[model samples]
Target: MKFNEWTIKDHYPEMALQDIQPISLRAYSLLNRNISALGPNEGAINLLGALEMLEALDYHFINFTQIEKGESPINQKHEAVAYLNRLGQLYFFTKSRFTKKYIPDSESHMPKVIEFISIRHKNTAHRSLDSPQKEPDEYRDRQAFTFLGATTRKFLGNEQYVFPNYNKDTNETEWFYFTPAIDHPIIMEQSYNLIEKIIKELLNNL
Candidate 1:
């Protein structure tokens, strides 16, 4: 495939709110940079950057609204599930009220994506003082992630929104999927859309 390109709008999508969180800002930044730096030497580094980028995006984002209210969870899995729950809540409340489907469920990743991210966070994102698992193969080679149906979702008439096509016979959304380099966009898109959704809610409702 050819290198990805971005338009002016892609680079600057309706200037972010004054009080936007760092997680959202960071994700947009990574996506912009990675998309721009698609080349031989740079692409690999950008991919790794994208990997670490999503760790922060998901880790910090899962805490977005809940953190200030003291509703944050200690475990990554809990935080992730909470994030998905909030998304579903928002969709239910807003979708019927608004004429437009402004926030596509496609933007959000299946919650089980947290399992892949949590490990990456430990290995690279956090880089613990205790012990972090660092192996050459993890980065040098493509990695695979498989998630069960519990964390997956497939909305009818929404096939156009799905990213990273899945095999119909052995779909993770149905049962499980194993694929590499799948975490960044999933985490980034949900965080990106969530931030926009929050801002819109404030502007339209408040």
Candidate 2:
């Protein structure tokens, strides 16, 4: 669906009345119509950024859904990255706009949300070297290798070899790697729920 067609009331019927409705309408108006009264201020800029990121989240989520339905792993992987990037941006934007009271230290969703953000950060945004000490346990000891030209053999896809190191002191494996995994549809559903919560809270604050 187009971004303009993504109405707040459709997803959140409870926000259709009272203070929330007006704020929601105004934000959309500023975004869609470029209203002058809402412009030329930090609040307007942040609100616009949040709304744009919200649109981006929906855009990537729909693309991921469509690609998954097509049953293509390669394309699905690319779309998943796109979706995660947008999700991270929205999460950070929400955090920036609200106080700790709104997002809180003990929020249940924070860990998963941070995982999603970290995936984008380490893999796509910055492209880390998979350091054992700095990277998470699952992302450590990774080496990307591709078999593009082999005279005697052929490989279907590139491989990332992971060397897990045993730490005697901890009595556990210290290094390992797994392809960054995310259940796109489930996470997207959670993201939509999160966006709704953020919008409600933001409007109430406004």
Candidate 3:
């Protein structure tokens, strides 16, 4: 489905109104300073990493949106995993580099950002056999396994996949199923906002 037709567009009108090229150029311009002049002690290194991750987030977002309905399940899953991975990495940079002065953890959207991070940690970054009981109870029962294309179902025939979880209790571990816990566009929008705030703050400091 097209981005404009998605319900998420209502919450992020700027996505439709503004072109990404200018925003990307602005971000690049802000980070284009000489690293040697800034020195090793400066936060330029962190900002550079954050900037790279931010660009990656945008790339994955665009790739996912461009995917056609009824496309190859492999392609669909690839975009989904890629987008979520970059989302988590960018959020990490925001917190570790930007700090609360720029983007606080108390923000309403932070929970969603952290959720994506946890999801990536369990599913992609560090897959495990058993779920760790943690504060975010949602992932407590989730196990780490390869997400097969057969396990994915399209969301309203869109590029998005609604992953279902398998009933592992039956001792049949051949399949892994998952209920969809993410709103892709909403998280993408929120992540972009946070990253933008961090980039602006970094530029101001520089």
Candidate 4:
């Protein structure tokens, strides 16, 4: 929630070997700035609220791993990754809506979240491997999947995760969902405040 102090560490736990991706960080900064600047516009405010909620869900993933424990190192990492996967679902919703409004015709409007994860894993694994004969362990892949599952849950509910079409409208829909392994809290109060701010600014400018 505190945008200024936020870091990738606050979301991705299993990826402890490195820092947050520059692209993601930039994305967050831009989203935050946009939200603040356009806070007075009703439509824009709603979008900003969604964005913040999504960001918080992600930030929670990073915070979850900060908990120290006496459990096996493998177990700790596995749990962290599980949460990461659950939290990732938020990106799906945000991507879907944003694309529908901004780039409706683009087939790839939805963010390639899994692809991003795969790239992250591949890069990290390759960097850690010593030689051509060495390959990243399969267990590491499992761990990354664990985090991914967590992200999905945080954003989508069980029904949505189990069957995305269950509550969805038929036809060309801009919204898509991932698995429901995570739980994202909807901060209506903060959302409303943001909305009010945007409305005020827009009215003042007009």
TM-score of each: 0.25, 0.47, 0.56, 0.32
Tens-digit per-residue lDDT, 21-116, candidate 4:
422333334444344444434354334455454455445444554545654444433444443353344334334554344434322322344433
Please tell me which model should have the higher lDDT, number 2 or number 3. Answer: 3
Q: In model 4, how large is the Cα lDDT of residue 167? A: 14
Ranking by TM-score: 3, 2, 4, 1
- When summed lDDT is taken over every stretch of 10 residues in candidate 4, the lowest stretch is 159-168
Candidate with top lDDT is 3
lDDT at position 104, candidate 4: 44
Q: Can you write out model 2's per-residue Cα lDDT over 1-206, one digit (the tens) per residue?
A: 22333323233334432233223333453343322322232344545566666566556655645653447455545555566677677667646734234555423554456545544555444333433344444433231111111111212342221223434467564433222223443444444444445444544554
Q: What's the lDDT for candidate 4?
A: 0.36
What clash pairs does model 2 have? none
lDDT of 3: 0.50
User: What overall lDDT goes with each candidate model?
Assistant: 0.35, 0.44, 0.50, 0.36
Runs off by more than 4 Å, candidate 3: 1-18, 21-26, 29-41, 67-71, 104-109, 130-146, 162-185, 199-206
Which model, 1 or 3, shows the larger TM-score?
3
Question: Under the 3 Å rule for N, CA and C atoms, how many clashes does model 1 have?
Answer: 1
What 10-residue stretch in candidate 1 is worst by lDDT?
A: 157-166
Over 1-206, each residue of candidate 3 has an lDDT whose tens digit, in order, gives 21122111122334432444434433544333323233323454555565566567667656766778777757756766886677676666656634566556625556566655555665655434454433233333344324554345554544444332332355332222222233654554565566556656544655
TM-score of 1: 0.25
